[model samples]
Target: MSDAFSPPPSPGGEVSADQRQMALFSHLSSLSGLIIPLGNILGPLILWLVKKDTMPFVEDQAKEALNFNITLGIIGIVLTIITVVTFGIGAVLTVPLGILLGIAWLVLTIMAGLKANEGQYYRYPFALRLIK
Candidate 1:
């Protein structure tokens, strides 16, 4: 993990303090999954939709967060189906996979949020860019 306080150059030129904070919130919003079902997806989606047109940095970060969450959701659904089909045998795989995914989501989300807060852009590894 690099310095979370360093700001990266914005694609649309200079970034404002307000834009950086909003972008940070957009990335952090994914953690809402811990309390609300699909809240991770919803949070980023709402932030992205609300800010994309106004802030380029927020738009990029929100879209990145949204795409990563969507990919994770798909993986989770597939894992659930596999567990169901195997009649609990797949729990061996699904359980660890779920744990790993959860940890990855948490860590990556925090890193992204920190980077965004610092005005830097962070791309999630292994995330499907489904939303372009």
Candidate 2:
């Protein structure tokens, strides 16, 4: 049994402070979607690719972040298509639903970052396991 004072263990042995920070960044990077097109996917992808060789913890967190963001992006695209195709009628439904999902994404991503910062493996409850 582990004591409460001990830090959480990561899958890849002892996680360094740098690794934890990178992992946290991996999860938080998804928020960049608000500024750059496809940034949600690209941010994690870049981080994962750049650090996967050296930081296993970061790789794990980045993959989770990437997959979750990808799933959210797909859902968002579908909602947008529905709204456009229905000529604003779908907005009555899709808009509110989209907003809710957006909030969920933000909340969940923040939670994941906190977990990663604590040296814990965080998995998205709804993310598709498309990356691995």
Candidate 3:
């Protein structure tokens, strides 16, 4: 394994098939949120924690997914609060906005997964990068 502090590896650069698969799964794990609450964050968090020491590629991808999902989760909470404060009035706008947010999250996540599967590094454009 390479030194952890070294610069991130290039796409398909010296990465084995196992590493690529793990990275791919790390990104796709966010889909767990579809069935389990906060699964998006939890999935990546668990994977990252388990593999961070051994798989740098998986660590990077999982951190990206975790950060992105966390940002979206916060936005969702704010949206829900707004809708509640407005007593359903905000729903008129928040509903559509929430749907759009979900769609965007899904699309971006799938894109990231595909990139990871292809041995490419993927960074979400809007992710907050909160997890370093």
* TM-score of every candidate: 0.90, 0.87, 0.89
Better of 2 and 3 by lDDT: 2
Residues 6-58, candidate 2: write the lDDT tens digits: 43364646789999999999999988998998888999999999999988888
Cα lDDT of candidate 2 equals 0.88
Model 1 per-residue lDDT at 22: 93
**Global local distance difference test of model 1:** 0.89
lDDT of 3 by residue, 36-57 (tens): 9888999999999999999888
Off by over 4 Å in 3: 1-12
Candidate 1 wrongly placed segments (more than 4 Å): 1-9
lDDT of 1 by residue, 12-120 (tens): 6667999989989998998988899999999999999999898889998999899989999999999999999999999999999999999999999999999889888
Candidate ranking under lDDT, highest first, comes to 1, 2, 3
Q: Which ranges in model 2 have alpha carbons more than 4 Å from their true place?
A: 1-12
Q: Select the stronger candidate by lDDT from 1 and 3.
A: 1
Better of 1 and 3 by TM-score: 1
Instruction: Decide which is better by TM-score, 1 or 2.
Output: 1
